[model samples]
Target: MYYVTKDLFFPPVSQANRDGILAIGGDLSTERLLLAYKSGIFPWFDPGDPILWWSPNPRMVLFLDELIVSKSMRSILNRNVFTVTFNQNFRDVISNCQNVKRNGQTGTWITNDMIEAYCNLNESGIAKSVEVWQNDELVGGLYGIDLGTIFCGESMFSLVSNASKVAFITLVEQLKKENYKLLDCQVYNPHLESLGCREIKRIEFLRILKSE
Candidate 1:
């Protein structure tokens, strides 16, 4: 049920038929990437694979005001063992997310092409990163696109246990400080749920999409 667009940069995919996948095989040009973000879709494919866009049935999102910090996490935050910063080292954050050992993944979908694409987006001010450091050593962090009031979280990695969680908590705290409405997690997982993420229908999700 996906529709194809004649525009080379915009694959033939309709909002209604995302199947979670909205399109396949397209360049991540700034204009197209921006359009995709504003419409609640994003590209996710590996090297040698055609660009694939997805908008899952039940999107995972976190309301910045509702972030549930556990008592243990609250204790850690109060300790302030690590400091957090924004856009201090975007490349490093993305690189860590790619190279860090994930639970089950062997290689990474954050291919060179994806790196370059997101880097380009970062340069244009649509994407950003949150980095965590312990005594000046980069430990954990994450990165994503910022469409005005919506922060679309892409990925995160941790060099130390609880470090990435620190980064996530910091990011949410900052977003709340800035009055952002939503943090799009894209897919649902227990890890995110523990961090206070919940599912909402796609129709509900688009209502938060930014037009600009």
Candidate 2:
């Protein structure tokens, strides 16, 4: 396994292990994070562990044209009961994602250092968040690195049923409007699969990521 240093460099995605861990022990500087996303790698590590960068094979991605909104979700959207906002309360959105309990995990990969680093990334306009509000209260949200052409989703949390889906669908509609090519989910997720996210080879993903 490769080890990261002060220099903002990484092994090629092809060098990643079968489990997708590409490098270890890197700081989450804005420059490094940007480079990692552009290169099909992302940071994900548990607390008290060295920062682990991964570039998984068979990347999970959603083409803007392929988003699948279930009938129930469509009804919820039609009702317009929840308000959605962009870049509003990013810290809260990410913090909630970090704190929310998920199945099969004792802790979150979105550590305090990761949060601070990505918050800085947010201030730089490279990281983005989608907030869902119900009756003026923040209920659910998602956050990620927006590379202009493709969105690399990091994490999402929902306090109420379908609130995260609402935030996700809303973000997809906006990205579709802007003519985005893809939404990179990074790894396999049944929830994302239900929303039409499917896996493609890492090479294909990298080609798309670098495409003009």
lDDT of the candidates, in the order given: 0.85, 0.94
Q: How would you encode candidate 2's per-residue C-alpha lDDT over 99-188 as one tens digit per residue?
A: 999989888888899899999999999999999999899999999999999999999999999999999999999999999999999999
TM-score of every candidate relative to the true structure: 0.92, 0.98
Candidate 2: C-alpha lDDT: 0.94
Candidate 1 ranges with C-alpha deviation above 4 Å: 1-19, 210-212
Write candidate 1's Cα lDDT for 137-209 as tens digits.
9999999999878999999999998999999999999899998998999998899999999999877787777
**Candidate 2 residue runs with Cα over 4 Å from true position:** none
lDDT, model 1, position 188? 89
- Residue pairs whose backbone atoms clash in candidate 2: none
The lDDT leader among the candidates is: 2
RMSD of 1: 2.2
